[model samples]
Target: MSSRHSRRSHGHSSGRNSRRTTQNTAQLIESLNTHRVNTLTELCRIERVAATASDEDQLAFQGPMTSAWTYYVTSNNLLSELRGLTRNYPFSSDALDDAKWRVSNDPESNRSWNYAWLVLIKMRDDQMVEAYAASEAAKPEMWGGRVPEAEEARQLAECFAWEWNEALEQMLRHWDTPPTTTGY
Candidate 1:
Protein backbone atom coordinates (compact mmCIF):
# COMPACT_ATOMS: atom_id res chain seq x y z
CA MET A 1 0.00 0.00 0.00
CA SER A 2 1.12 3.63 -0.57
CA SER A 3 2.36 5.57 2.50
CA ARG A 4 -0.33 8.25 2.06
CA HIS A 5 -3.10 5.63 1.85
CA SER A 6 -1.80 3.86 4.99
CA ARG A 7 -1.66 7.13 6.94
CA ARG A 8 -5.20 8.05 5.91
CA SER A 9 -6.54 4.65 6.92
CA HIS A 10 -4.89 4.86 10.35
CA GLY A 11 -6.28 8.35 10.94
CA HIS A 12 -9.76 7.20 10.02
CA SER A 13 -9.52 4.25 12.40
CA SER A 14 -8.39 6.49 15.26
CA GLY A 15 -11.24 8.89 14.66
CA ARG A 16 -13.75 6.06 14.69
CA ASN A 17 -12.30 4.73 17.92
CA SER A 18 -12.48 8.16 19.55
CA ARG A 19 -16.07 8.56 18.50
CA ARG A 20 -16.93 5.15 19.87
CA THR A 21 -15.35 6.05 23.19
CA THR A 22 -17.31 9.24 23.40
CA GLN A 23 -20.52 7.45 22.59
CA ASN A 24 -19.87 4.84 25.26
CA THR A 25 -19.21 7.51 27.86
CA ALA A 26 -22.40 9.30 27.05
CA GLN A 27 -24.36 6.06 27.33
CA LEU A 28 -22.80 5.31 30.67
CA ILE A 29 -23.74 8.71 32.01
CA GLU A 30 -27.31 8.17 30.89
CA SER A 31 -27.39 4.77 32.56
CA LEU A 32 -26.09 6.31 35.78
CA ASN A 33 -28.84 8.88 35.75
CA THR A 34 -31.45 6.22 35.16
CA HIS A 35 -30.15 4.09 38.00
CA ARG A 36 -30.17 7.09 40.34
CA VAL A 37 -33.77 7.87 39.51
CA ASN A 38 -34.85 4.27 39.93
CA THR A 39 -33.09 3.95 43.25
CA LEU A 40 -34.62 7.13 44.56
CA THR A 41 -38.04 5.99 43.45
CA GLU A 42 -37.64 2.67 45.20
CA LEU A 43 -36.46 4.39 48.35
CA CYS A 44 -39.42 6.72 48.35
CA ARG A 45 -41.81 3.85 47.80
CA ILE A 46 -40.38 1.89 50.72
CA GLU A 47 -40.47 4.94 52.96
CA ARG A 48 -44.07 5.67 52.09
CA VAL A 49 -45.20 2.11 52.65
CA ALA A 50 -43.34 1.80 55.91
CA ALA A 51 -44.57 5.14 57.14
CA THR A 52 -48.17 4.25 56.43
CA ALA A 53 -48.09 0.64 57.57
CA SER A 54 -50.15 -0.35 60.57
CA ASP A 55 -48.60 -2.33 63.43
CA GLU A 56 -50.06 -5.57 62.09
CA ASP A 57 -48.93 -4.79 58.56
CA GLN A 58 -45.50 -3.44 59.41
CA LEU A 59 -43.88 -6.86 59.38
CA ALA A 60 -45.07 -7.32 55.83
CA PHE A 61 -43.23 -4.19 54.80
CA GLN A 62 -39.85 -5.46 55.95
CA GLY A 63 -39.06 -7.31 52.75
CA PRO A 64 -39.70 -4.27 50.60
CA MET A 65 -37.65 -2.11 52.92
CA THR A 66 -34.75 -4.52 52.70
CA SER A 67 -35.04 -4.56 48.93
CA ALA A 68 -34.90 -0.78 48.85
CA TRP A 69 -31.85 -0.86 51.07
CA THR A 70 -30.11 -3.16 48.63
CA TYR A 71 -31.02 -0.88 45.75
CA TYR A 72 -29.76 2.15 47.63
CA VAL A 73 -26.43 0.42 48.13
CA THR A 74 -26.36 -0.49 44.46
CA SER A 75 -27.00 3.16 43.60
CA ASN A 76 -23.86 4.08 45.48
CA ASN A 77 -21.95 1.60 43.38
CA LEU A 78 -23.38 3.12 40.21
CA LEU A 79 -22.30 6.56 41.39
CA SER A 80 -18.80 5.26 41.96
CA GLU A 81 -18.76 3.73 38.49
CA LEU A 82 -19.95 7.05 37.05
CA ARG A 83 -17.17 8.91 38.82
CA GLY A 84 -14.58 6.49 37.50
CA LEU A 85 -15.92 6.72 33.94
CA THR A 86 -15.93 10.53 34.00
CA ARG A 87 -12.70 11.03 35.93
CA ASN A 88 -10.64 12.43 33.05
CA TYR A 89 -13.49 13.55 30.81
CA PRO A 90 -13.63 17.28 30.04
CA PHE A 91 -17.08 17.79 31.56
CA SER A 92 -16.51 15.62 34.66
CA SER A 93 -16.10 18.39 37.19
CA ASP A 94 -19.58 19.78 36.82
CA ALA A 95 -21.11 16.35 36.40
CA LEU A 96 -19.45 15.07 39.53
CA ASP A 97 -20.51 18.12 41.50
CA ASP A 98 -24.08 17.76 40.34
CA ALA A 99 -24.07 14.06 41.20
CA LYS A 100 -22.76 14.71 44.67
CA TRP A 101 -25.39 17.37 45.20
CA ARG A 102 -28.11 14.96 44.09
CA VAL A 103 -26.84 12.33 46.48
CA SER A 104 -26.64 14.81 49.34
CA ASN A 105 -30.13 16.06 48.68
CA ASP A 106 -31.78 12.69 47.98
CA PRO A 107 -35.02 12.42 49.94
CA GLU A 108 -34.15 9.03 51.33
CA SER A 109 -30.39 9.36 51.46
CA ASN A 110 -30.22 8.58 55.16
CA ARG A 111 -31.25 4.95 54.83
CA SER A 112 -30.05 3.87 58.23
CA TRP A 113 -31.76 6.70 60.02
CA ASN A 114 -35.04 6.23 58.22
CA TYR A 115 -34.99 2.47 58.62
CA ALA A 116 -34.19 2.69 62.30
CA TRP A 117 -36.87 5.23 62.93
CA LEU A 118 -39.48 3.22 61.08
CA VAL A 119 -38.56 -0.02 62.81
CA LEU A 120 -38.62 1.62 66.24
CA ILE A 121 -41.99 3.14 65.59
CA LYS A 122 -43.39 -0.12 64.32
CA MET A 123 -42.07 -2.05 67.29
CA ARG A 124 -43.44 0.54 69.67
CA ASP A 125 -46.89 0.17 68.23
CA ASP A 126 -46.86 -3.63 68.41
CA GLN A 127 -48.25 -4.70 71.76
CA MET A 128 -46.60 -8.11 71.67
CA VAL A 129 -43.28 -6.59 70.72
CA GLU A 130 -43.53 -3.89 73.33
CA ALA A 131 -44.39 -6.42 76.01
CA TYR A 132 -41.38 -8.46 75.05
CA ALA A 133 -39.14 -5.41 75.12
CA ALA A 134 -40.51 -4.32 78.47
CA SER A 135 -39.92 -7.73 79.96
CA GLU A 136 -36.36 -7.72 78.70
CA ALA A 137 -35.81 -4.22 80.01
CA ALA A 138 -36.91 -5.30 83.46
CA LYS A 139 -34.29 -8.01 83.71
CA PRO A 140 -31.52 -7.22 86.14
CA GLU A 141 -28.75 -8.61 83.96
CA MET A 142 -28.24 -7.14 80.50
CA TRP A 143 -26.99 -10.31 78.77
CA GLY A 144 -28.89 -12.96 80.71
CA GLY A 145 -32.36 -12.61 79.25
CA ARG A 146 -33.62 -14.43 76.21
CA VAL A 147 -33.91 -11.84 73.43
CA PRO A 148 -37.36 -11.96 71.90
CA GLU A 149 -37.76 -11.14 68.23
CA ALA A 150 -39.01 -7.69 69.15
CA GLU A 151 -35.94 -6.92 71.24
CA GLU A 152 -33.78 -8.17 68.39
CA ALA A 153 -35.58 -5.77 66.09
CA ARG A 154 -34.88 -2.93 68.46
CA GLN A 155 -31.20 -3.86 68.60
CA LEU A 156 -31.06 -3.94 64.84
CA ALA A 157 -32.69 -0.52 64.75
CA GLU A 158 -30.11 0.79 67.18
CA CYS A 159 -27.33 -0.57 64.97
CA PHE A 160 -28.87 1.25 62.03
CA ALA A 161 -28.92 4.45 64.05
CA TRP A 162 -25.25 3.99 64.82
CA GLU A 163 -24.48 3.41 61.14
CA TRP A 164 -26.45 6.52 60.19
CA ASN A 165 -24.51 8.69 62.62
CA GLU A 166 -21.22 7.24 61.45
CA ALA A 167 -22.07 7.89 57.84
CA LEU A 168 -23.09 11.46 58.65
CA GLU A 169 -19.85 12.05 60.49
CA GLN A 170 -17.87 10.69 57.54
CA MET A 171 -19.77 12.94 55.15
CA LEU A 172 -19.04 15.93 57.34
CA ARG A 173 -15.34 15.09 57.44
CA HIS A 174 -15.27 14.57 53.70
CA TRP A 175 -16.94 17.93 53.10
CA ASP A 176 -14.56 19.71 55.45
CA THR A 177 -11.62 19.06 53.15
CA PRO A 178 -11.13 20.48 49.68
CA PRO A 179 -11.95 18.13 46.84
CA THR A 180 -8.93 15.99 46.04
CA THR A 181 -7.91 15.11 42.50
CA THR A 182 -7.11 11.53 43.44
CA GLY A 183 -9.75 8.77 43.61
CA TYR A 184 -13.21 9.37 42.17
Candidate 2:
Protein backbone atom coordinates (compact mmCIF):
# COMPACT_ATOMS: atom_id res chain seq x y z
CA MET A 1 0.00 0.00 0.00
CA SER A 2 1.06 3.61 -0.62
CA SER A 3 2.37 5.66 2.35
CA ARG A 4 -0.54 8.13 1.87
CA HIS A 5 -3.15 5.34 2.03
CA SER A 6 -1.48 3.76 5.11
CA ARG A 7 -1.42 7.15 6.88
CA ARG A 8 -5.17 7.67 6.32
CA SER A 9 -5.95 4.11 7.54
CA HIS A 10 -3.87 4.61 10.71
CA GLY A 11 -5.53 7.93 11.40
CA HIS A 12 -9.02 6.44 11.02
CA SER A 13 -8.20 3.51 13.37
CA SER A 14 -6.71 5.84 15.97
CA GLY A 15 -9.84 8.01 15.85
CA ARG A 16 -12.05 4.98 16.44
CA ASN A 17 -9.82 3.79 19.31
CA SER A 18 -9.96 7.21 20.95
CA ARG A 19 -13.74 7.31 20.73
CA ARG A 20 -13.97 3.80 22.18
CA THR A 21 -11.74 4.74 25.10
CA THR A 22 -13.91 7.80 25.80
CA GLN A 23 -17.07 5.70 25.71
CA ASN A 24 -15.59 3.12 28.12
CA THR A 25 -14.55 5.85 30.54
CA ALA A 26 -18.06 7.35 30.48
CA GLN A 27 -19.55 3.91 31.14
CA LEU A 28 -17.18 3.38 34.08
CA ILE A 29 -18.18 6.71 35.63
CA GLU A 30 -21.86 5.88 35.20
CA SER A 31 -21.36 2.47 36.80
CA LEU A 32 -19.54 4.03 39.76
CA ASN A 33 -22.41 6.47 40.28
CA THR A 34 -24.98 3.70 40.16
CA HIS A 35 -23.03 1.57 42.63
CA ARG A 36 -22.65 4.47 45.03
CA VAL A 37 -26.38 5.20 45.03
CA ASN A 38 -27.31 1.54 45.48
CA THR A 39 -24.80 1.00 48.28
CA LEU A 40 -25.96 4.09 50.17
CA THR A 41 -29.60 3.06 49.85
CA GLU A 42 -28.82 -0.41 51.18
CA LEU A 43 -26.82 1.04 54.08
CA CYS A 44 -29.70 3.29 55.08
CA ARG A 45 -32.10 0.37 55.00
CA ILE A 46 -29.74 -1.71 57.14
CA GLU A 47 -29.41 1.08 59.69
CA ARG A 48 -33.18 1.48 59.91
CA VAL A 49 -33.67 -2.24 60.37
CA ALA A 50 -30.98 -2.41 63.04
CA ALA A 51 -32.45 0.55 64.94
CA THR A 52 -35.88 -1.07 65.10
CA ALA A 53 -34.71 -4.59 65.91
CA SER A 54 -35.20 -5.87 69.43
CA ASP A 55 -32.51 -7.79 71.31
CA GLU A 56 -34.89 -10.69 71.89
CA ASP A 57 -35.99 -10.67 68.28
CA GLN A 58 -33.00 -12.48 66.84
CA LEU A 59 -34.95 -13.21 63.66
CA ALA A 60 -35.43 -9.51 63.02
CA PHE A 61 -31.70 -8.92 63.53
CA GLN A 62 -30.67 -11.58 60.99
CA GLY A 63 -31.79 -9.76 57.86
CA PRO A 64 -30.17 -6.46 58.71
CA MET A 65 -26.97 -8.13 59.95
CA THR A 66 -26.71 -10.14 56.75
CA SER A 67 -27.41 -7.06 54.66
CA ALA A 68 -24.78 -5.11 56.57
CA TRP A 69 -22.21 -7.83 55.92
CA THR A 70 -23.07 -7.86 52.23
CA TYR A 71 -22.85 -4.09 52.06
CA TYR A 72 -19.43 -4.18 53.73
CA VAL A 73 -18.11 -6.63 51.14
CA THR A 74 -19.73 -4.87 48.17
CA SER A 75 -18.70 -1.38 49.28
CA ASN A 76 -15.07 -2.52 49.65
CA ASN A 77 -15.11 -3.76 46.05
CA LEU A 78 -16.72 -0.54 44.83
CA LEU A 79 -14.21 1.59 46.72
CA SER A 80 -11.34 -0.31 45.12
CA GLU A 81 -12.86 0.25 41.69
CA LEU A 82 -13.45 3.92 42.41
CA ARG A 83 -9.82 4.38 43.49
CA GLY A 84 -8.60 2.81 40.24
CA LEU A 85 -11.10 4.78 38.13
CA THR A 86 -10.23 8.07 39.83
CA ARG A 87 -6.55 7.47 39.11
CA ASN A 88 -7.30 7.20 35.39
CA TYR A 89 -10.08 9.80 35.15
CA PRO A 90 -10.65 13.16 36.80
CA PHE A 91 -13.42 12.02 39.14
CA SER A 92 -15.05 14.81 41.16
CA SER A 93 -13.78 15.47 44.68
CA ASP A 94 -17.37 15.31 45.96
CA ALA A 95 -17.79 11.77 44.65
CA LEU A 96 -14.64 10.62 46.41
CA ASP A 97 -15.69 12.36 49.63
CA ASP A 98 -19.13 10.76 49.51
CA ALA A 99 -17.61 7.31 49.11
CA LYS A 100 -15.30 7.86 52.07
CA TRP A 101 -18.18 9.22 54.15
CA ARG A 102 -20.33 6.20 53.49
CA VAL A 103 -17.61 3.84 54.72
CA SER A 104 -16.87 5.91 57.82
CA ASN A 105 -20.54 6.29 58.77
CA ASP A 106 -21.59 2.69 58.21
CA PRO A 107 -23.61 1.43 61.20
CA GLU A 108 -21.93 -1.97 61.22
CA SER A 109 -18.41 -0.69 60.61
CA ASN A 110 -16.97 -2.44 63.69
CA ARG A 111 -18.21 -5.91 62.86
CA SER A 112 -15.64 -7.77 64.94
CA TRP A 113 -16.35 -5.67 68.03
CA ASN A 114 -20.07 -6.16 67.54
CA TYR A 115 -19.67 -9.92 67.20
CA ALA A 116 -17.60 -10.04 70.38
CA TRP A 117 -20.25 -8.10 72.26
CA LEU A 118 -22.96 -10.41 70.96
CA VAL A 119 -20.99 -13.43 72.07
CA LEU A 120 -20.43 -11.97 75.54
CA ILE A 121 -24.10 -11.15 75.87
CA LYS A 122 -25.10 -14.61 74.82
CA MET A 123 -22.68 -16.17 77.28
CA ARG A 124 -23.87 -13.94 80.09
CA ASP A 125 -27.47 -14.81 79.39
CA ASP A 126 -26.76 -18.57 79.29
CA GLN A 127 -27.80 -18.65 75.62
CA MET A 128 -24.31 -19.22 74.23
CA VAL A 129 -24.42 -23.02 74.15
CA GLU A 130 -27.61 -23.14 72.14
CA ALA A 131 -26.58 -20.30 69.87
CA TYR A 132 -23.12 -21.75 69.32
CA ALA A 133 -24.45 -25.18 68.45
CA ALA A 134 -26.97 -23.74 66.00
CA SER A 135 -24.31 -21.57 64.38
CA GLU A 136 -21.41 -24.03 64.49
CA ALA A 137 -22.07 -25.95 61.28
CA ALA A 138 -22.10 -22.83 59.17
CA LYS A 139 -19.32 -20.94 60.95
CA PRO A 140 -16.41 -19.74 58.84
CA GLU A 141 -12.92 -20.69 60.00
CA MET A 142 -11.91 -17.13 60.89
CA TRP A 143 -15.19 -16.15 62.59
CA GLY A 144 -14.72 -15.09 66.23
CA GLY A 145 -17.03 -16.60 68.85
CA ARG A 146 -16.86 -19.10 71.67
CA VAL A 147 -19.14 -20.30 74.46
CA PRO A 148 -16.66 -19.45 77.17
CA GLU A 149 -17.24 -19.65 80.90
CA ALA A 150 -17.20 -16.35 82.82
CA GLU A 151 -13.67 -16.93 84.10
CA GLU A 152 -12.49 -17.87 80.64
CA ALA A 153 -13.95 -14.70 79.18
CA ARG A 154 -12.20 -12.66 81.87
CA GLN A 155 -8.88 -14.31 81.13
CA LEU A 156 -9.31 -13.77 77.38
CA ALA A 157 -10.04 -10.06 77.88
CA GLU A 158 -7.00 -9.70 80.14
CA CYS A 159 -4.79 -11.45 77.65
CA PHE A 160 -6.04 -9.21 74.88
CA ALA A 161 -5.34 -6.11 76.97
CA TRP A 162 -1.80 -7.28 77.75
CA GLU A 163 -1.09 -8.09 74.10
CA TRP A 164 -2.43 -4.69 73.02
CA ASN A 165 -0.18 -2.95 75.55
CA GLU A 166 2.82 -4.90 74.34
CA ALA A 167 2.06 -3.95 70.73
CA LEU A 168 1.79 -0.27 71.68
CA GLU A 169 5.12 -0.48 73.51
CA GLN A 170 6.74 -1.98 70.44
CA MET A 171 5.25 0.75 68.25
CA LEU A 172 6.60 3.40 70.64
CA ARG A 173 10.07 1.94 70.42
CA HIS A 174 9.92 2.02 66.63
CA TRP A 175 8.68 5.65 66.72
CA ASP A 176 11.74 6.65 68.78
CA THR A 177 14.15 5.27 66.19
CA PRO A 178 15.78 7.82 63.87
CA PRO A 179 15.40 7.49 60.12
CA THR A 180 18.28 5.71 58.34
CA THR A 181 19.55 6.96 54.98
CA THR A 182 21.14 3.59 54.17
CA GLY A 183 19.07 1.00 52.24
CA TYR A 184 19.01 -1.14 55.44
Where in model 2 is the C-alpha error above 4 Å? 36-147, 150-184
Cα lDDT tens digits for candidate 2, 1-184: 6999999999999999868755644443344344442343343343343344445433444444444434444456433433333343222233333434444565543443222122222232432323322333233331355455555555444443343334323322321221111110
User: Going through the candidates in order, what is the number of backbone clashes in each?
Assistant: 0, 0
Residue lDDT tens for model 1, 8-110: 9999999998687556444433443444434433344434544444554445445545454444444454334333333332112222234345445655444
TM-score top scorer: 1
TM-score of each: 0.28, 0.27
Best by lDDT: 1
Residue 128 displacement in candidate 1 (angstroms): 30
* Residue 96 C-alpha lDDT in model 1: 29
C-alpha lDDT of all candidate models, in order? 0.41, 0.39
For residue 175, give model 2's deviation from the true position in Å: 25
lDDT score, candidate 1, position 85: 35
Q: Which regions in candidate 1 have their CA more than 4 angstroms from the true location?
A: 36-71, 74-180
